[model samples]
Target: MPTIKEIAEATGRGKSTVMRAVKELGLRESGHANPDGARGALIIDAEGASMLADFLTKNVEAKQAAGEGETESSNQPHIDVEAIVSVYRERIDDLKAQIDNLNAQLAIKDNQIKELTCALDNAQDAAKEAQTETRRAHDQVVLMASAGVWERLTGFKGLLGPGSDMDSQ
Candidate 1:
């Protein structure tokens, strides 16, 4: 298999642009990943080679045929399968590098999301527990007041005066 950069160089186009074209052409990496985790290139048969050649020819001609302001030299030369494929191999390497980078980023984001979710759950649980504690404390204070502890502390006054026990009345 060819690297996309090599393919682009041979085709007289930018590397990224050629890479996109190859991807759009439905070319997938073989399952073999390099140490960097790029899909390795596959060995193409005659039919695949011919197809690539035809694609290059049509691509070059299409651009030239558009009758835009391109110079004569701007049009690509005859397509050489061997050279193009050579460049394509390098492009495949670059693509693998990109894939590795994206995978690493995704892993980091996944970890971060997991941590944040855990923290959120902990915070929610803590809030609920705190609310329960507050409710329990309020109940204890109401019980103490209903039992008349406040009046007993003051040792009694006239029944109808300030701080008197209405319950007794």
Candidate 2:
């Protein structure tokens, strides 16, 4: 005889699943006094467990066969191929429109990048020109100072005279 746990282990299923299978297969269970002080225990002989397993296997095979038959019958209904093709065509057109819109956006971005690059180049050229002008002005100031032009313009002769403290330097 096998307990519910032993049958579950043998069948690789839960106790409740084995019990349901036993019930569905109409297998009779023997009643025995519970060693753990419970009322009774329901057990199945080896022959009954084997019969239950066989019955469950046949039942599953039958269900699978019926499911396959149902699918075959369900697929026999007439399908409109033209409608499906038209739906796919519309989807393709929509995807093409999306591609065109993306291309337009990319073109706009490229134009903006080109404009920004041109503006950067112009700013760099202007900066170089400003540096050159600054250097020329500095050279003109040094030349005038060495020639005592500032002192002559201000009428301070002794301040920048040839033998004075400024000339000795």
Ten contiguous residues minimizing lDDT sum, candidate 2: 28-37
Task: Assess every candidate by TM-score.
Answer: 0.44, 0.40
Provide the clash count, candidate 2: 0
Q: Ten-residue segment with the worst summed lDDT in candidate 1?
A: 28-37
The alpha-carbon deviation from the true structure for residue 122 of candidate 2, after best TM-score superposition, in angstroms, is 1.5
lDDT for position 105 in model 2: 100
RMSD of each: 13.0, 21.9
lDDT of 1 at 168: 55
How displaced is residue 50 in candidate 2, in Å?
A: 50
* After superposition, candidate 1 runs with Cα above 4 Å error: 1-56, 59-78, 149-151, 154-169
lDDT of 2 by residue, 2-118 (tens): 566655555445678767876666665332212232745556654454555555455556666778856555323233334334434545676698899999999999999999999
